[model samples]
Target: MNDLQQQLAAIVGPAHVLTGEAELASYLTDWRGRYRGRALALVKPGSTDEVAAVVRACAAAGVPMVPQGGNTSLCGAATPDQGGRSVLVNLSRLNRIRQIDAANNAITVEAGCLLAQVQEAAAAAGRLFPLALASEGSCQIGGNLSTNAGGVQVLRYGNTRELTLGLEVVLPDGCLWNGLTALRKDNTGYDLKDLFIGAEGTLGIITAAVLKLFPRPRAVVTAWLAVADGAAAIALLGRAQARFDARLTAFELISRQSLDLVLQHIPGSRQPLAAPAPWQVLLELADGGAWADLQADLEDFIGGEMADGRVQDGVLAQNETQARQLWALRENISEAQKIEGLSIKHDISVPVSRIPEFLDLAGTALAAAFPGVRVVAFGHAGDGNLHYNLSKAQRQDNDAFIAATPQANRIVHDLVARLGGSISAEHGIGQLKREELVRYKDPVGLDLMRCIKSSLDPRGLMNPGKIL
Candidate 1:
């Protein structure tokens, strides 16, 4: 073993330090198979102190360090570079729920804890940690915080940024910043936690965090409704917000193309409605009231919409089993898409009102550019973020079209920029969107970001080749 490898092995038992190519293969490649890189070694540290020690050693040796958790990044945020000069610091061994203060409505946990684990812990204490995502079962808290991930429940609960209360990070120089406070209101100075929460491990390595929790809803309802198009869905969203307000937990918009892909690729997947529509909405309502009353109220609302022909058709989940089945249809879109084939994907967000315009323009432009291009659009319309993906219908054509990703991205991202939208909503600017970020990011804002990065990591040793 090399000197640094030996030091890493000593810091966290030899069993935790991985050097074999087979042992490091999975950590090197991203889940989407889009990014594969080489690393000096993959080291798993069991505690925050060990992580700090490893970071100090790497910093002293002038080796780049890449902080990785869960390895489920859609944007390759956790993957290393091709240089093979950096050490991959895997934080999975630091999984631990340090504290659960039910009264304080907060929980402190290590970065390696799976998002699902944190959610379960919150539920056990009669609280809700509402950072719901499709990959929550495998994705870890550190990555979620690093990417500021948004999911179906973002309409009501906001993203990871809002759910986070404090952070414990190991800076580039190996100093530990313990801002792990549970307080909600503290305007003492600049919010340091915010800087690390969405920094994508570029400035430092996050070791642990304190996250906020909400009252567990006693009553919950889920439903699937059919809408004519984006405009109709947005109109329905406005009405639903007017009536249900905070009771509405999620409002997802799915294109017929996207739903068809899911049904065709995902086994046992069935249509939520008897009649098919061009667009569909999967929404949920939750409160601490009686379930029967909440269900009845939603039923009345749906009856009124259907009577007016505003909603084409709909089905309300009868029970928890039905609810899970309905949600499965929405959550499995990405998996189904992967099964179909490779796609040029874009995670963009415009103002809630301009989503229809963005969709109409981008769809028309893409169709004009490449006929028979299949566009799979779906996501949390409640937050104006949409997962827009494109590919040709046939495998041969798609294989060729994959090479035109730059052109497809220009069409979609230009529309996003013109509409004052973000090229990356929930997904971080990993290797995938680094170019797009440069093209669209404001010059002044970009300069400030670079300055901050330099200030925190002068040598650029932290997660090199990501973000800025």
Candidate 2:
């Protein structure tokens, strides 16, 4: 074994150091199964101290370290690059909820804890850890923090970065930064935790965190609304927010093609509206009181929207089961798309007011560029984020379509930029979006990011070939 490999094995026992092809295979491929890489070894560290030691050993030997958590990154953020010189630091063994303070409404947890486990811990204490996602069961909190994940509840609770109170990170040099303070108000210096929150494991390795919690919602109402177009969905959102305000937990927009894919792929999927409109919005509202009256609120708002012809048809959930059924249609989009086959995907975001314009312009531009291409656009519309994807025609095979990704991205991302939107809204700029990020980011922004990365990781050993 090489010097660095020996050191890694010593740091986290030889048994935890996986060099076999089969064991390392899963760590190399991303969630989308798009990019696959090779690594010298996969090192599993079971604690913050162990992580620091492993990182320090790698730094000493000048080996690049790829920090992996849950391996659920859509953008290959948690996957190692093909270079084979680096070692993958798997953090799944560190999963643990260290503490849950009901009084402070906070939870201290290791970075490898699954997001769903954190939610359950909060629920046990009669609080809600609202940073949720479709992959919560497998995605770790560290991955969520790294990507600054935006899920359905982000409209109400905010992204993982906002929900975070503090973090424990292993610096590039192998020194541990104990920033895991549970204090709600820490007016201390640069708020260093914010730097690592969305760094995509490039700046440092996040080992643990202190996450904020909220009072559990006593009532929730989920509704599926059929809208004529993206503009109508935006208008409906505005009208509902005027009445519900903070109670509005989520507002998702699903395109007809996207919904059809769900029905075609997922079992037990049924249409919510009889006459399918061009677009659908999944609206959700939750409150902490028993007298939340979400039904009355939705009925009144839907009544006005229907009268104004903004909404054509709708189905409000009568119970929790019905609510989940509605959500299943929204949550299973990625899975359904996977079943459909390979496609070019974008997680773009614009200002809430300009989403309608973005959708119209991007759709028009893409159609003009690639005729007969199926556009599957859907996602958290309330946050101005959309999972805009384009699938090849049924007759065309995957390879022919895959070759058109660059052209398709140009048509879609250029419009997103023109509309003052982010090329990468929720997904981090992993290996997949590194080139796109360079193209779209302004000079000053890129320079600042470079400065931050150079300052923290002077050796350029942390998660190399990712982000900057």
Cα lDDT tens digits, model 1, 72-114, are 9999889999999899999999899999999999999999999
TM-scores vs. true structure, each candidate: 0.99, 0.97
Model 1 lDDT-worst window of ten? 268-277
Pairs with steric clashes in candidate 2: none
Off by over 4 Å in 2: 395-398
Residue 13, candidate 2: Cα error in Å is: 2.1
lDDT of 2 by residue, 1-468 (tens): 388878888888999999989988888999888999999999999988999999888888888999999998888887787778889999999899999999998999998999999999999999999987888889998898998998988887898888999899999998999998998887967899989988999999999999999999898888899988998889888888888899999999999999999999999999998887799999998897663476777788888778887789999988999989999999999999988888898999999999889888888887787777788999999999999998776746556767989998998888888888899889988988989998999989999999999999988999998998
Residue 420 in model 1: lDDT:
94
